[model samples]
Target: MKLYSLMTTAVLIASTSAYYVKNQKSETFSLNVTPVDAGTQEECKTCITFAGQTINDLLQFVLQEEVDVCGDLCQIVVDKTGKEALGVICTILCDVVGIKEFINAIQKADLDPIYFCELVPACPINDNGDAHFTSLEVMPKKGPQGEFDISFEYVSNNGTGTGMLAISVDTVDGIPLGDDFLNFAQPAGTYDGTIKLDAKENPDCDPTQGPCETWEPGTYTIHLSVCNGECGSNHPHSAIYDTKTTTFEITQN
Candidate 1:
């Protein structure tokens, strides 16, 4: 219970910040939202789960203050994941998505419990017809998995250009397990599709070129973000349009 109190205090501190980042309608952050009562761990394995969304919100709120110190934290993520190319994401996520909006979304969790993935671009707040994610689901959410499929709908309200849907599979603590980038001509419409992923798909090293890291039996995070331009590691743009995410467990095969 002490852990919970410490965590809550951190969240309160973040809530009192005077800073305000603009959203779709140029609105400031608001913290009038209350967290849901997350149940026990027996029913929920990961904080990202539907029943555990409150936990996810609390985590994001607590980390909102960390953006100032993310230089060190971001390096740790890059060092562990070896994706030094996209290190800017760590800062972009925190700075772009303020804690005020997190609470606002949490109040509406009855309709949809948005995770961190949803929160980032979701953090961007789609109040102005900005592209946002919906209907995200991971197949066989739990089990001894060698393969899986991620299906979701992305609504783009912008012009047709090189839009990117970046996917990264990582551990709960931020170590990447694998990553994929879906770049396509996105116009004003909603695109829905399911991507097939295998345990053999490695993000660290390319299997086609050499040996790579395979999926292991553990809880992992699948993070997806949408942006207007090329968002590859080498290619960096200013912002992430939106995001969708889920967590799953991989058991022994």
Candidate 2:
């Protein structure tokens, strides 16, 4: 049942809220990460469908706003006291014994995905992974000409499928770069910001199918690859499950 056709890969960085009021003092920052081991292939087996599917029905339809796991600790508030640090913060890391980690390690765990959606779980037939950070945007500093706007969200199926959402950065010496593809169509969703970054090989996302760049900051990484490709299209055209890889991280302070 590899009827692949699922691509919800996104990375957006917004700019021009008057360019953060014209850089007040330089604390400008933006960092976002969404990765919980996406969906470990073999058709797609995100922790064997939660083994018994209970952690609130596997996050009411698989995470959208927040779900915390891994040693029990979570914080994604990039910025909250602006007098000089505009704003931006997003952090997500997973694999804490999976299956939604007993309701994301409970501490009042209820981030709201329609209040656990209905215990999520419907893409199964090989579900094809991705459940976290349905949306994220951060812009700390660097405007006046740097500009910004970024977005990310995944999980869709209308029938036919194919997926690959990507964005990357880091190469002062670390080398991990990508900046191409604001949106790659299908029955997918969410793809904003089709302007800005006019130079440096042109890439706010998807300049022709690749990760191009010109923003030299510090550390960076952003990639989202979800390929269900209409479930392999009758296995022809050099068949190969299409694609599947969900990774996240965006940093600059």
User: Tens digit of lDDT per residue, candidate 2, span 1-253?
Assistant: 1212112232233321100001011111232222222232311222122221223333343454454443222222112222111111011113323436434332123432111211222123223422233444434223322444444343343421222233443344453544322111233233322112221224345646644455454433334333332222332111222232332232443
Residues 111-158 of candidate 1 have per-residue lDDT tens digits of: 232223344332122223346787677778987756566666766666
| TM-scores vs. true structure, each candidate | 0.41, 0.22
> In angstroms, how far off is 162's CA in candidate 1?
1.5
How many angstroms is residue 32 displaced in model 2 relative to the true structure, after the best TM-score fit?
11
lDDT of 2: 0.28
Model 2: residue 214 alpha-carbon error in angstroms: 12
Clash totals for all models, in order? 2, 50
Backbone clash pairs for candidate 1 read 119-123, 120-123
| TM-score of model 2 vs. true structure | 0.22
Model 1 residue 250 distance off true place after TM-score fit, in angstroms: 1.1
